[model samples]
Target: SQITIPILSGDEVNAILILETNQEPRFSLSDWDFARRLAENAGIAISNAQLYAELTRADESKSEFMAFAAHELKNPLTPIKGYAEMMLKGATGELTDQQKQIMHVLRTNAERMQTIINDLRDIARMDARQFRIELSPIDIYNVVIETLRPFMQQLEEKGQTIVNNVPEGLPLIIGDATRLIQVMTNLVSNAYKYSPPGSTITITARPETSYRTPNGNLHKNVMYISVADNGIGMSEEDLQKIFRERYFRSSNRAAQDQPGTGLGMMITQHIIELHNGEIWVESKLGEGSNFQFVIPLAVEEGGDTPETSPDAATEPASD
Candidate 1:
């Protein structure tokens, strides 16, 4: 007696399973049914394996392209920014007020382009597992202030206000100060970009206990930081997908019109993760959004908590 079953993936046959037996009884209905089920499972597994391979290839290709494009785009920006700065400083000659304004615009756009390119490069490095952070004991308060300094002019121009409520005396955290600044900058920039004129963006931080790490370990002390803005908020759907998808821009017209590559949040998430931390958002449509993250505090050699002054004044960054 002989029995054969075809393994199918969708409508196509992927393989055949054959059974041969020399006995008084031939293959029973139950045996044939079991064989068919087994073949079906095999076909599904094979299909899934094929699909995963294709996806891996596509991801590698995308990473390569991103790296190449960022490199090429950044190369030309060096001279563009350099010449703009030189002309603005009268290296070429004295400029009229109009010419200086033109140079300022040129320099600003060039800087924006450079920022986008750097983001792309960071994304590529993250994909390639080459992204790194230099850890050190740092004051979160200083990081917040430094991050806000560059945005002061932008805040003034947009009529936006930044309330820096990051208190002093918070326990020092072991983190990359530069990366943390980058994370803060991205959050504050988004707050400014989305909020209406004269709206207030508030930054706050505090100490927390018993925070859990990704590897199931618990840290007894952690620093919690948040950037809250009364800008256009997100829906439940957008909130769910924001960190999961790259290049995800909101469907809101106001959001769509804003200039962004949709990579800031992604990079911010990665930086937090590198510090063994987590980031999250809370928002309501037409209201505003608050972005938050927590990083574990550093412990001293003798298990004593080394502390700083938590008495930093709560004030606006524009101050």
Candidate 2:
């Protein structure tokens, strides 16, 4: 009254049927064959999922690798482009005021290009985990003052405000000051670029002791700096890719024909990592943004804390 059968084909096989002796059994090869087929289908589905997951991981890794490589190669290229552009316009030779004016434009664009290339290179180097820190003890308050002085005209003409939140008596830190300045420049420039005509950009600096390695050692007290703007913030999707090498442009870039190699954050991130720091962002799509990064506080010396309105219409820094 009972019958049992096993179905076998290729490496994949299905269920074995069992029938009790107490009941009449009406099973044969046909029923067993169908059951085996169903089981094989399930195995195939599982295999597909595994393959898909592998593919996703590979894609992310490849993206990260290329991005890092590209960033590392772009930094030193800036000055090269700048001098070449200058010579082409005969900056060394005397020229009329009109000619000099056009040459100035050429220089400006060249500088912008250099910024983009360098930013890309730095970010890539960081992503690839090959960046080395070149640190020194220096006052950031002086650094900010010097950096903003040149941009004063631009800010004033646009009716923009620059707020400093760094207090006096803050201890100097051992950091690559030039690179640190670059980070602030990128953040500040992005804030200014995205803010409306009459808005403000605030730069803040404060001592932070919260960043600690799992080991008990205090990971050099850190400094938290943020460049914030009340501008046309960004979407979650846009925010997700801000540090990605992939170009994600807001509407302003498209309309103004804003140009960049889209490597600023890639470089900024690398610089931060090289200094043993952290970086992150917070924003609302239409309201504002705060781009924050931290650096080792005592990597050289103190405690300190210090220091936007935008409704719309500017480039929100290229990714």
Candidate 3:
């Protein structure tokens, strides 16, 4: 005699459970009840496994699409930006005021598109575990200053001012100088975008000798930096989700009005983590916001001094 039980997931049968015996009684009432119960549990587990597989496939597909799309979109932007720059520089001919303004708009939008494409590519690389940074001894103050240079004109137009409180003489930190600049630029840009005209954005930094990680690990000689602004701040709920969620945009009207992909903070967080650092934000609804990060200082082989001079290297802005 043989008995067969079907494993049902929702209304569909996913598999069969069978028992065969040559005895007079192939199965008992209790045996049948146990087999059915076991089959039911197995069905649920199989369904969950299938669902997880589907989700993984979908995530992989999305990342692939983002990478491909970003590459394709980036190709045509090169010529567009080049031509705009040539025209602005009078390569073709002397441009009129109206023509200059038009070219400026073209160049600005092209640069913006390039920034978005780079973000998408970075995100895709991060998903594939291919995103990397070149670390070296870097001055946090110099990085802050270089990052703020391009924003000066925009700040002036908006009647906003920036105060650089990141003093010199602090111990140099081990980091990717370019990536650190990117992180600083993102924070300052957000401050400029969300803050009211005439508001002040402050950049501050200091050395912390007793910084402790959440895991109770004490980090000696870490550089702490913060970008603070009296902008339209975020809610407690938003502060909770900002770094955790990718492409997360706040529900505030000011944030909604800003043109952004909501990927900057997530990318900033990833960059900090790559350097064995931590970043966080403090904010209230009507009050300002403070975005801060801390990275360990670079220690020389024989002593605690930095290997490189802070004034030795300077990163120039691109056109």
Candidate 4:
């Protein structure tokens, strides 16, 4: 049956085309022309609707960035700045162990704020196509180590568990080390945030020799890295839209509430793509999630990648 719904949510109206071809052939030609015009009009309406959605999303992203900058970013920075001033002035007598620890937390979080800001600015440049990757031969093993180090102290303090399953003799890939590290950092951070206390988050990487690119081309010696967590996974609907801008926490996350800018994953995509790699996620509602990224093995200088290793049983130890 021909669709009865109006085109583009009634931003334009359309009707079915029926013809009495048994009548004048001239009349049929006129009817067909009108029908063609209606179809063309529908396409225009769809284009306009798509343009509207893009504009709206851009505006919403901008507004969301401002709100986060003012509330989440600025609010934390103020106290951190004030405390540093107090410590420098010696106005607040000798600091106790607890005070020193809290100060350290503040200083660390303030540095994190700077990192988030840098990511945001990088995203803007990326969207403008002005971003470039500094490709090099990278030791992904060391990259994983460096990326996971900053969170070690925090994980210990929170009593949270992390398991790093990346193998010791993994193939190195050619890509931008900084961006890949950023991608891993974002996924690990998100996993840590949504995961319950004492639950474990595992980071794993394996070479994918069987996978093909979207263009149906074969990629040799490609490695796929996954960061998986035993946390509250996303719903099917949420999984479908997880990379969308401005998505916040789920309805069930009261205790796990964190400052979520929602652009983290979006920016992560930009970074990975900039490195000429692909990233995706798999999850179930109650089961855990696995965020994965793929990069070619030849990108690294010293990676004489051998045949794929049969090491599915290895556990992550970087946690």
Taking all chains together, each candidate's TM-score versus the true structure is 0.82, 0.60, 0.89, 0.65
Error of 3 at 13 (Å): 3.7
Worst 10 residues of 3 by lDDT: 310-319
* lDDT for position 187 in model 2: 78
Reference-based TM-score, model 2: 0.60
On residues 1-319, what C-alpha lDDT tens digit does candidate 3 reach at each position? 6668999989999999998888886688888888889998999999999999999899889889999999999999999999999999999999999999999999989988988998999899898788899998887877987898889889999999898887665788999999999999999999999999999999999888768754456767888889999999999889889998888899897789987788989999999999999988889987889998889888898987644445434534321
Clash number by candidate, in order: 6, 15, 0, 6
Off by over 4 Å in 2: 1-100, 123-130, 211-220, 251-257, 299-319
Ordering by lDDT: 1, 3, 4, 2
Off by over 4 Å in 3: 21-26, 212-218, 302-319
Ranking by TM-score: 3, 1, 4, 2
* Top-scoring candidate (lDDT): 1
Give a tens-digit lDDT track for model 4, residues 107-223.
767766766666666655555556678876566776788789889977886678777777766755777888788888889988887777788888888777667754455656678
RMSD per candidate (Å) reads: 4.2, 10.2, 2.9, 8.8
Query: What tens-digit string does per-residue lDDT give for candidate 2 at 165-246?
Result: 8654565655887778787887777877777889888888877667543334354467777888998787787777787645
List the candidate 1 regions with Cα displacement exceeding 4 Å: 1-16, 22-33, 167-169, 210-219, 307-319
lDDT of each: 0.89, 0.66, 0.88, 0.70
Q: Pick the candidate with the highest TM-score.
A: 3
